[model samples]
Structures are given as C-alpha cells and as structure tokens.
Target: MPPRDPSALVAEMSRAEKLSLVRGTADPAERATGYLPGIERLDVPPLRLVDGPLGVRAEGERATAFPATLATAAAFDPALAREQGAAMGREAVAHDQHVLLAPGVNVVRVPHCGRNFEYLSEDPVLSGTVGAALVDGIQSEDVIATVKHYVANNQETSRTQVSAAVDERALREVYLPPFRAAVAAGVGSVMTAYNRVNGTYMSDHADLVGGVLKDEWGFDGYVVSDWYGLATTVGAATAGLDLEMPGVPAPGAEDHEGEWPDGIPDAGHAGLFGDPLAAAIDDGRVPSERLDEMARRVLGQMARIGLLDGRERTGELDSQRHRDLAERVAGRGTVLLENDGVLPLADDADVALLGPHVHEAKLGGGGSSETTPFHSVAPDEGLRARADGTVTTARGVPPVPSRSLFDRLPYLDWGRDDEESDRPEPSLDDAVDAAADADVAVVLVRDATTEAEDRDSLALPGRQDELVRAVAAANDRTVVVLRTGGPVETPWRDDVAAVVEQWYPGQADGDALAAVCYGDRDPGGRLPVTFAPADTYPASDARQFPGVDGTAHYDEGVFVGYRHFDAAGLDPTYPFGHGHSYADFAYGGVTADGTDRVTVPVENTSDRPGREVVQAYVEPPTVEGVDRPDRVFAGASPVELAAGERREVTVSLDDLAVRRYDPDGGWTVDAGTYGIAVGRSARDDRASVAVDR
Candidate 1:
C-alpha cells in the first residue's frame, strides 16, 4: 500500500506511538547515528539519521569520504556543491538511512573555531548560497536534508552552556541569513544548537525558534535538538523543538562513549522527553496539541520519502562515480595561494615529500563529521604513483598533539587510548637533508582540530613553522601545502616557492595534490576566509569569543571576515577569494543592473586553460548614523575558459547586498549610488560600475 495521509495516521495512533516518533533511541541494527523504532501495526519502517557533511558516515561501516565542507565552499560553485550533496544522499540511502545530519550552515564567525572545516564560510552570502544548493540536492533523492546549529555556534569552547549574546540587528543580518536560505530552499529538518542564544537556550528559544523560524519565516519543517541539548520537556516543545535526539541514554554509560549514565542526567537531570514528558502532559504542563504536531511532522516526512510505503529505496557505496567526484572536488577546491612559476612541476622532477602527513591521509577534522573510508591515499603514495622521477619521503616533525574537549581535565582523556599518540619523534635533520638534495620539496602540514576544542591561535600548531622555515632555507624551491581546518599564519610565505591551501581533502587527498602539482588539473579553489594574524580577527578577545562569564558578546556586530578587514582598514595576509590560476583572465565591459545583478566579459588571455571564480561585490549607499562594510559579497559564479576564450558572466545579487537591517525600521534600503565591482578576489577588483538605488 502507498503511504497514508500523515494527519489520518496521527489520528489512528495512541499517545505512546506519537511519543516514539518524536524521540531518538538506539538502533537495533547498530548502523545509524540516531534511530526511532517504527510501529509494526502502522507499517512505518525504522527512521534512521546518519552523520555526514564530508560524506555518509555510517557507524562501523565504510563509505566514500569526500573533502571537507570548507573545501567545497572554496570552489565558489553551488552546482558542484549540489552534485556532492546528491552523491551523499544516494550513499545515505545505500546505507539504509532516512535522514542525513549534514550541511552544517553555521557561519565561520570565529576563525579559530575547531569545526571551521565543517562549515561553509564567514560571509553569510557565500554560506547561504552554497548551503541552500546543498540542501536542495540532498532532498532531491528523497532523503531528508538537515541544516544545523540554528543560531551562533561559531566556537566550540563552552558550547553546551555558553550564551551567544548577539543583538537583533546582527542576528538578522549576519547569523540568520544561512538558516533562512536553507528554509527557503525547503530543507526538511532544522537542528538546534547546543548553546544558548541571547538569554535563552536554542532548543528552548521561543522568540527565534517559534517566532522567527516557525512564525515569521513560515518554516514548516520539524526542529530537532542537538544530542543531549534539550533543556526542559515543556519549555523546549512549547518553544517549537519537536524531537529529542538520543532521548534516553544507554543502560551503562561508561561502556559507551559520551552516553549519559543510566538514571543519570546530562548537566543536571536525566533525559527530559521520555517519562518526564509523559508526566508533564498528564499535569497539563505541556499541551497535547504540541505533541500531536510533532507526530504529524515526523509521519509527514516518512510519507513524503516513501518510508511508510511497502517499497525499496537504495543507493550504492564506494561507487566509482563517487570516487571520481571526490577527486574532482578535492582538485578543484585546492587553492594556490602563491606561485612564482614554481608550480606545475616538471613531470619527471625529483620530489621530496616532507611532513607528518606524508604517510597518513589528512581525512578531516575530528568529531561527528569524521568518516572511515575503505581506502585513503597518503601524500607520498600519491606522488610516488604519479611521478616518473624518484619520490623521497621524510618526517620533518612528529604529528602535533591532537586536542580534545577533555584536555583541560587532569583525569579524563578522550580517544587517547584509541589512537597511538606516543610514537617516536621523527628526525627533522633528515627532512632538511632531503630538501637540499631534491629538485622540489613539497612540505605538507596540518592543524590538529576537533569538535570538542577550539584552537588558541591561528599559527600552525607545534614546530611545523620551524620545520617549514628550515626546509625553505635548505631549498629555495620549497612548496608548502596546508591541510588545515581553517586559515593559518604563514610567516615563511615569502621565502617559499609556492603555497597551496588544501583544507582537509579526504580519501582523494594524495591524488588531488599530485594532479595539481603535475598540471594534470588547475588549482581552482579560492579562500573562503581571510588569512591574517591571530590577534586581528573580529572575535579576538576572550570577552567577545569564549566569553568571560557565560556569554559570548558579538561586539563586532555585522563586521565579519572581509567586511571587518575593509571596515577596520587592516591588511590580511591573503584576502578572501584570493587564489592564483595557471592562466590569467582579463575583465572588460563590467555592467550593473542597478543593485539586482552584475555582468562582465572575461577572456582567458594566458596560453593555458583555467577556471575563474568571478565575484561580484556591492558597495552600499552611504547613510548618516549607519555603519556598513565598504563592499559586501553579493554573489559569485565559476567559469571554465579555454585558452583565448572570451565569454560574458552574470552574477545575481543576494538581497543582503542592497539592504541593511535596522533596529527600528527593520530591513531598509539606502537611496544613493551603489558601486559594483567585478573581480577575482575581495581586494583585486578588475572592473567597476555604479548604479542608483
């Protein structure tokens, strides 16, 4: 039989059945990240939600691990991101998952955020545009797509309890755009953040969750809580949170990682939604209608995806097509930060691979997004396979100590027993010797980041900086490849021959780097976030970031990333969207259709073909008593051009480009001349035009 109407099904179910649909439990199959058992009488199959953003991460199973979400954002191509999303959705179905907990839409407000690699960008326009496309593609396969961390989840420090004290103007302008875009794209699920927003917890935030998301935006999707994130049964549900993930902890918590102990509560109390919720409903503390709506939403999704029907829905794992996509995305998203004719090495040049990552692949930053793929290629393996000349390897320094959320505790240590952390220190002298002898030295370095922790500094962790400087001194032909979660300080940039920002490329790391090194593919990625000294970032101080007491203040307001750089007149080491192509592009005939869109003619004037990411920035009209960035990222489009090819490129503007959020007036447009610039990066504007708003 086809699926029955959700409302009709709800009418038939008892209170217990309705409760089952709104709470997560352990999966009997032991494969999914979160599970809800189905009612056999109603013929509703078990609903499973899996963790993925990099790729489908099935528990204790192998899947295709693609590059990090940050890498996808670096490409500045929503179409490519959508393709990746669709592939992930298919893989989820292959693993028998109904929902994919992915495409985290949290804006990269803090540069040192531990999970920066998991997010898209610092700029709302870039994050929203790419995030919406990913959501659309995931849902195309009938797998429910989730856009997460509903409010400001920028930092990992004190995540569960800290309050993000942001004003209304900044909330509407900076933090809310991505979630709004995801809702606009019709995403099926929205996950609440672990932290509090303003003075209220996100799972219990009635103003933002109920008023803004549900009422104002007309969001019809179900809202789920972050694991162990539900505050009060009555408060959260009344505020519009519909589901409690992993509702009840297992019998023995110590036997399982991060699970709440039996009869013990997380933070202060045991789980709130199981028996406690039932008591609340009996006493009228919680209205029965809210519970009915929760059941309806879950059932509606099951019906929409054919989960309630007697049919089969499946996809393939480790498909050749997906593997090819992983390589293509990793290659395209590799940003060439600097190159003085040292890249595209000779096919037979003797290569020296130096760094701790030479042996192990830089899959991704740790935590939920971590995926275990069937196969992964290391940097040395990739170079050896692709190079005709001899490829030598050396460990310049031992791997950096991986930090965890438990690092502050003297007793508790997470994952220390699992991973071998006491390996003998590698020889740094051998790396310098190898660099001196080899024709070209490619030094790969990485920052040890995890979901439970935030980096204290943007400089490369450990003595990797020392190793890079020594290697550069040993051989002037040294190329540094950073496999980090976010931007890092590059003091030796001027000394090195070239620099490549390959942010946590997954299973295809080696192959992608090899291809870019040998000119098999062009470095098509750009910087999604600016690279600068650690002290210069917007949320630099303790009071503004991790917070002094229990609240993180958004003091910078709407000024973030490039907006902050332009407004404060500070020079970044590498501006946002900064990247070099093998071939140069010439811009001409730049035109603006008022504040709506911009178009420009681009010609590949170089002898080789290349990919160009044309960015459109809109300079807002000046108004007294109002502050705005000199230019805001409106929209961007990527174009592939053959040698001597010329074509016209048009980029549509996001509504944010022409409007600003006012405290009293709401969204208001300033009337004056708006300047539009078409360029390769934020600072390198090639052409400009003006329009009256």
Candidate 2:
C-alpha cells in the first residue's frame, strides 16, 4: 500500500499516541537533536532531525562542511544556494536524518549578532531568494528543510527573554519575508524563535502561528520549538506549536553543565509534553481536533520525506563531488574588500603566512552550525600545494579560546587533537621578524563569537589590531584574510595592502583561500551586509541593541543595514553589495521591460573571466499613508562571463520588493515613477532608469 492518508493515520491514533507524536521522544537512542517515537502498532517509524544550516552536526559522522549560509548569499546566486542545500541534504540522508534544521532565514538586522554568520543577509529579498532556493534543493532530495528562528530573532544577548517590539509594517517588510519565501518554497517545518515578538512569545503567539502562518499563508507544515524554547504546554498547542524539543532536560539535578552533554542531550524527561499536555487534552483546554491536526502535519511530512517508507541511500555522503561544491561556494563567497595590486600572489613570490587561523580552518562559527568535516584543508596545506614559492608560517597571536559552548564540546575536539593546542603565543617581535623579509605577508584573523552571546565590539578581538599593525609596518605588502562571522571594524585597514572577508569558509577553507589569493579564481562575492563603523549602525542605541529591560525596540523602523546609513546620508566602511574584482567591468545601458523587470548591459573590460552580481535597487517616492526606505534591494542576479564578454543582466522584482505593507490595508504599490539604479554595489551606482507606474 502506498502509505495511507496522513489524516486517516492520525484518526486511527489514540490520544496518548497522538500526543507522543507531537513531542520529542523520551528514548535515549532516538533523541539526539531531533526525534519522535513512533507507535509500533501503527507502523510509524521515529523521525530524526539533524542540525545543519552549515552541515550535519552529528558528532562522529564526518560529513561535508560547506560554507556558511552567509557565504552562499554573498555569491548572490540562488542556483548555487540550491546546490549547497542539495549537497547538505544528501549528507543528511546518509546520516539517516529525515529533517535538516537548516537555511536559517533570519535577517541580519545588526552586525553584532553572533549568529549572523549562519544567516543570509540584511535585505529580505536577498535572504528570501537564497533561502527559498535552499529549501527547494533540500526538499528535492527527500529531506525535510526547516527555515528557522522565525521572526526578529536577531541579537543573541538576552535572546531568550528579550521582546522584539517591532511594528507590523517593519515585521511584514523586513523580517518576515524570508520565512514567507521559505513557506512558498514548500519547506516542511518552521522553527519558532527563542525570543518573544511584540510582548508575545513566538511559540505561544496565536495571531502569528495560528492566524497568520497556519491560516493566512496556508502553511500546512508543523511548527517546532527551539531546544528548551517551549514556555507553556497548553499555550503552545493551542497556538499551533507542534513539537517541544529535548523535553525540558531532567528537572531535579542539573545532569551536565553545558547544553548538550556528551554531544547529545539526555532526552528521557517529559516535563512539559507528558502530564501537562495530557491533562490539558483531558480537561478539553486544547481541542482534540487541534491535536489531530498536529499529528497529521507531522505524519504528512514524514510521508513526504519518505521516512515512513524507510528511506535509504548510499554513495553520496562525503563524496568528491560534494567537496567540489563546497570549494566553489567558499571561493565565490570570498569577497575582495580591498586591493592594492598586490593580490594574485606570484608563483615566485616568497610568502610569510602569519596568524593562528592560517594553519587551522575556521570552518564554521561556534554553536549548532559547527561540524567536524571528513577532512579539513588547512590554509598552510592549501598554500603549500598551490604556491610554487617558499611559504613560511607564524602564529602571530594566541588562539582566541572558545567562549562558545559548542567549541568546548568533547566530540568536536576529537579531530582537533593534532592541532598545536599548547603552543606558545608568538610575540609581536616574532611576527614582525617573519614578515620583515617576506615578499608578502598574509595574516589570517578571526573573531570568537557564538550563539547565545554577542560581540562586545566590532573591533578585531584581543591584540589582533596590534598584531596586524605591526606586521603591516614590517611589510608594506600585508594582506589580511578575515575569517569572521560578520562585519568587524578594521582599525588597520589603511595599513594593510589588501583585505579579504572569507566569512568562515568551510572544510575546504585552505583550498578556497588559496584559489582566491593566488588568482586561480576571482573573488566573486559582494557584501550581503554593510561593514560600518560600530557607532553608525542604527541599532547602536543602547536601548536598541542588547535591549533595555528585556525589550529590543525596533525604533529605527525599516531603515536597517544599508538602508539606515543611506537614509542618514552617511557612508559605511564598505557598503552592502560592495566588493572589488580583479577584472574590470563597464556598464552600458539600463532599460525597464515592465513594472517588475529590469535589464542592464554589463561588459567585462578585463582579460580574465570573472563573475559579477548586478544589483537593482529601487528608490520609492513618498506617498500618502506610507513609509519607505531611502533605497531597497529590489533584485539581484549573478552572472559568470569570459574575458570581454558582454551580456544584459535582467532582474525581476517580486511583489514584496516594490510594495509597502499597511496595518489596515494589505501590500500597496505607489503610483509614481520609481528610480532604479543598476550597480555593482549599493554605493556604486553606474546607471539609472525611471519607470512610471
């Protein structure tokens, strides 16, 4: 039989069995990260969820670690994003995980957020475009794709308690678009954020989860709470949160100090979903029909992912093909922020690789996104293989110790044993000595930010600024390779000869870095988020950032990221979509096909084949009863062309791009001429065209 209707299956299930299906399993073996016990009587198999907005988070399973989602967004290619998801999905299947909690669609509201590396971009259009593609790719491979941290889960500090007091218009335009895109892409699950929204916890929000998502948007997928994110049982079920994760870790004695003891939480407790939920159901507080709906959604997804049919596959896990995909993402995502004609290191040039990260791959940021790759390519190893010149190495600074809980876990430390853990921190004199004689000095710097915490400042952490300045002083040709999760202010930016933002490149970090540094590949990425001074960011207000009295007021409204800086008539250190290319390109003409379609001619003026991201931004005019950002990222398209190649890049704007949302009314388009700029980055507008609606 071709699997009975999920509705009929739920109808056949007893109330207790249905209740079990809605919550995480209590069995030790089944509950790693995601789990649900199946009734043997009903022939339902346990569903397994795995962590991966980067890659599989299985402790011992050596899966492929691709670049962070931010990196994929930097590529500005939804097709590449799809490939990234497909690769991760294949790896998830190999690990026997039905649901891959991935493609975190949370908008990068503030640069200080520790988890921004895992997110896509500040622009809702860009984030949604890439996120939707990722969802489609993962689901194509019979894996359940979860678009997570639903609505305004921006900052990590006080994340569990802070209420994001956002207006309805900002929520619709800025934060919620990515999740809407994910739902439109047919994602199987949506994970509620830890924080509350407008004084209501997302897990218990009736208007959002029940009214908007379930009814208004017609999202049929189940809603799962973040680990330990379930606040109340009756409220959650009635509000449409289908699953409570890890079941409120054993109450009496704190079994372990960290979140995941032994790389997996002991899920043997049923604190919230057991007696509390059963009593609520028995007393008729939560309707039985609602329980049946939850069971149906879960079973429906299980059927969709082929979990009920015992889905199995082989030969796709950790394959060479997957590695190539990872390298491509890393290479393309590497943004050349600044250059002074010193890059594309000559084969004969002598190089001094100075920094702690040069010999180690800062594969991904700390937290749930961290993964132990099957094999990680160190920067030194990659440089040695690619460079024909003499390559000397030095640890310029002490390794930034792990403040992240995931980095301290024993399982992640398994493959890190071979690294120089106890090596003495090299003095500044030692680093200067190494760089003094080299033709070029490449310094790899990083930031130690993780989930549940935010960076203290945008400045490079510790004595890294001093280290970079000293090295740059010693050698005029100093190149700084930043492996950070998000934007960091560069105090020594002028001192360095060149700067590259690699955004925590994955397992093939070494190979990817080498390819971009040595001219084997061009830095094809543009900034998805703005690199601004710490004080200039709109969220710089003390009350806005870490929040005041456990509430983050979105007082700046829709002016976020580049939009904020633009509205303030201020310039950023590096504007959103800003990146330098080795090859030059000239813009020719701009034309509008329709209200939504735009075409711009771009011709590569350089001899080398290069990739270009043509960005389309709209300057919406002020209208009655509406608010608009100075400029909004309407649409963007990535194109690869050979030397002297000419092409017309066309970008089509969706309804969300040109429309403004109102509380009393739905999305409305203004009846005026909108100025469209075709450019390389948000700051580099080459051509402009106006179209009257």
Candidate 3:
C-alpha cells in the first residue's frame, strides 16, 4: 500500500485532535520529552522524541556512547559520521524512540561556547557535509533525524533571552548552510533555538522559519521548538513553528536560576499549544488552515519515518559490535597535535600514567548529550592491556566540580558523577615522583565543561596545569593527553614532548588512547576548530563574548575560526586541520578541472601506515567594493594509505563552497581567477593551482 497522505489525515482530525497533535500531553511525565498524542480514532501514534547527538540519552538506559560530534568532525570523513549516526539511530530504535533530537550543525563561532562539542565545526562546509550525512543515516533507519538549534545559536550564556545579532550575508554564508544541507538531506525535523535571531524570537521568526527555510529552501518537514522554547501561540503558529516541544516542562523542572515556580506542573494547559491555541483559532487570531498545516507537517514526518506503517523496535542497543564501532570511530578522531619522537611508545618502556582522569572516564560533556554507557575503559586499564612493561599510575589532581546547575539534577546526571570508592586519590607530589621513576611520563589532563555556561577561560580549570608543568619538569619525555570537549590554551605546549587531543573519546576512551600511543593505530584525527591563545580569538573582547545587555553582535562577520587568523595574519597555537601521524604524507601536486573540481596526489613517505586529510582552500580574487576572507575552505578529502601507497583524490567545490553570498543577488558564483591551495592544514600550503571560473 502507498504511504498515507498527511492532508487526508489532517482533514479528518477535529479541532481538539488537531490541537493535541500540535502540543504534547498536559502531563509532562506521562509524555515523552518531545511528544504529541495521535487521534485514537485515526490510528495516529504519538511521536516520541529523545536527545542523541552522541548516543540515545534516555535516562537510566545503558547505550553505546559514541565520540563527540567534533571528534568525528576531525576525521573529516562523512562516511564515518554516517555510520556513527546509524549506530545511534539503531540504539534509538532499540529504546523505542521515534525522533532523535540531534546532529547539532550550529557553527562553532567561538571556542568558549558551552555546547561546541555537540556541534560539527567552525566552517559551514564541513558542518553541512557532516550534518547531512548523519541525517541521511538516521532517516535510513526509519527514524526522524532533527537537525537542531536553528540559526545563530552559537553561545549558551543567556541562550533563552539573548539576541544573536547576525547580518544577512553572514547568515546565508556562514550560519544557515548546515541547516540548509540538513533539509536537503531529507531530515524529518528542524529544531528552533532558545535565543532570538536579530530582534525576533526564532520560534516565531517569520523571515527565517517561513520565508527562508520553508519558502526558499523548500523544506517539507515540521519545525519543532526547543524544550520550553516556545514564547508565543499565534505568532509562532503563524510563523511556521509546527510543534511546541515538551509543551509543558517536566515536573520539578526549575528555571535557569534554580527556582521552581508554584503551580508550574499544571501550567501547560494555559500555554501556547493547548487551550490558548484553540482559543486563538476560535477568535480568528490564527487561521484554521494554519492549524491544519501544522498537523499535516507532523503527520507527514511520522509517515516518512514509517511510524504510520508499524515499524517496530528490533535493532540491537548495547552489544559488543556497537562498542567496537565506537572504538573505531574514537580512534579515527584522536588528534596527535604535537610529537617529538616520544609518541608510539615502545611496549617494553616503563610508563607512568599520572592524572585525576587516569581512572575516571569523562566520556562526554554534561546535559542532553550525556549517555550511560554499558561500560567505560579507563586509561590505566587500557594501557595495562597493551603495554608489556610496568605501568605505574598517580592522580595528579582532584576531579573538577560540576558547575552547571543541571548537572546536579537527577535526569541530567546520567550516572557520570558516581565515584569508584576503591581507588585511592594520589597527590601532585606522588605524580612527580612517579614521573621521575618511570622511563616516560604520560599525563592525562581533562577540562570538565558542561552545558548552560560558557567556560570562564580557556586555561585548564584546576591544579592540572601546575601538575602538568611539574611532571614535565620531573621527566623531559613527558606526554600530555588532553581529554576535552574542545580547544584549550596550552602554556606548556613547547615544554611537553607530545600532546594528544582526545576530545571526549566516549566509552572507548581508554582503549583508543592506548592504541594511538602504542602504535597499534595511527592518530588520524585533525583539528576541526582552531587552537589559539585565549586573547587571539575574534570574540575576545567583553562586549562581543557572552554579550552585554542580552545581545551578541557578530562583529567579525564571516571571519570565524581559521579565517580570522588568516585575515589578521596572526598565528594560532595550532592551525585548523593540524594533526600528526606516525608516517608522513607528501603532496605531489594540485590540478584544477577548470570547473568546480580539483585533484591532488598524496603519498605516504614513511614506512608506517597513515591517514591524510587533503584540504583545499580557495583564495578569492580581489573585488573592488566587496570584502572577503584571506582564504576559505572549499572542500576536502580524507585518504588512508599503507606504507608507500599513493592515491589521487578529487575534491568538488560545490556552489556552497565556491560561491559568495550576496545580500541582494543571493548565492552568486562570480567569474574570477581562483587560487586553490592544497595542504595538510589551513596554514600549511604544500601546493597551489590557479583556475578561472
């Protein structure tokens, strides 16, 4: 039988049934986080939504914890991202979930953004490509994939109240592309952010949601507001916000300041979607046809995901196969930032694993992306399994405290704060002694950041910085393994023998780090965002970051991440796309096809196997009146090679990459002489080719 027509179902639904389809149940606990009951007479099933950028974030449920989206973004491989998304989707189905609220494609406008780990990258092209892949993978599993935090939801501070002051051109070129890609990938849902875009709230923004997204982009999916994110009834309904998420905040939920208001649990009946919406329709504040459109969109997504056809939950959730996939994806994104002959430690070499995180597994950040993994591998246990010599360990510092108020909540805790009572906490002196006695010191450092608050600074949070510096002083062959969600300033960067950026490597954190350090796996990951000194970032000023008076102005325009550094001619600690492998790769040359494609030959120059990410950046010719970045990332290709293996990879610079966003003309591909630089990183240009468009 053919799929059900959403219009026919909407026409059959009465006013009460249609309103219920748009808003969740009046009781929050009874309904899934983002859910709306179906009309019983019409056999419409309730939509059950769950959070899952990393994994299925179902409370009290054990699931596979995959690496952070930024970690996978470092791989620069869409295929791997798709597989990871499929794994998450499989587990979502196993958990009986319908819509997976994930694949946050918001551009990492600032490193200090609290939720940067949940996003893909600073460049729109990379974020869009990776986001589309995840959407495709999730939809393939007969599940609805929600690409979230629509528009410039770059920061967490004042997220609910602040306005992101982004201009038209920047929105078109830098911020909107990823969501556009997700729509193009056939995503079933698009989630609005908590903040306002310009002066209007995104949930009720007419130009953004209705004009740009629905009209221009031709998106057929429904627009769901963030949890407790809906601000109005008629305005949002008319502006194209199809569903109000968690229409009622869950019972016992407190406001941002940690205060629970009186009679909040029963407050859902009076809000945007229940009685208020029905009243609006009766008074002609909103047309009855608009309500029909909203119901049609929601039912259409359910029909598309096969929910209307009785798709069952049968996929495996926490098996060893899923764990193996997590390990593989984790290892691929472990970036070897700096190495000076100390990495790939010999199996027989005595090692000292010193840090608070040596035994504890900081799998991921705090909040909705959090997951309860079946099991987690700690660093010492993984090294003990791989190293054939004595491996001593010491805790250099105490674990950082959870600063976010949500971390203390039961639902958001996700079993991450539980302590292993049997392990003894070691001190800084013990770590220094262990470093002096061992052949090499492996210092495990972690920066624990959570949602709802931007990091106070980029420096390592606690006494870990002192511990690292002391350990390096004790042993010249000290290696610093940073397990963080995103970039951090390294004051002792030059002093350490090596630095490995293992960005929240999920459940396989220990084993993956062990594999990279012991030569079993190459550190194939690259930096998805730029690593610069705290003061060098574009939003370093007080007026720009966190914002003043609830407004964040995008003063730098299109120059974000490496683009800022390139335009200012300033050097970052490590440029974007920077990473190290056991083997070296040589770029033969770059040739353009004169159209929208370029091919580059890369060869492994060492005896060891390696992976290379060939990055292509376009240097636009100077236009008299227009301003552009020094160079923009056009596209990239990732290649794996055996010793002495070579391959010529072709990269296509689609219109999104090659063209510039015009305020009046839209996306325009101008006729000009373009310089394409093919290199390992944004700063390392190995070869260049000229082409005319």
Clashing pairs counted in every model: 2, 0, 0
Each prediction's Cα lDDT score? 0.88, 0.85, 0.85
Off by over 4 Å in 2: 26-31, 248-270, 310-315, 407-419
TM values, all candidates: 0.96, 0.95, 0.96
lDDT of 1 by residue, 131-226 (tens): 999998888888999899899988888788889989998899889999999999988899999889887999999999999999999988799998
* Residue pairs of candidate 2 with colliding backbone atoms: none
Report how far residue 607 has shifted in candidate 3, in Å.
Answer: 0.6
> Candidate 3's residue-wise lDDT over 1-693, tens digit each?
457888998888788888888876543344244667677798887778888798988755778989888998988889988988888888888877888998999999989987888899999999999999999988888889999999899988777778988889999989999999999999999999878988898999989999999999999999998877887898898899999877765554433334422111122322478788889989999999999999999999989888777755567788888898899888999999999999999999999999876886667887778888989898999999999989999987876665443544533333544464456765889999999999999998887776777787898888989999999999999999988878998999889999999998999988998999998999989898999988899877867787888889899889889999988899999999899889998888788987487898889999989888888888888888888888888778888899999899898775666788889887787789888888989999999999887
Rank list by lDDT: 1, 2, 3
Off by over 4 Å in 1: 254-270, 403-425
Candidate 2: give its CA RMSD in angstroms.
Answer: 2.8
The residue-level lDDT of candidate 2 at 216 comes to 89
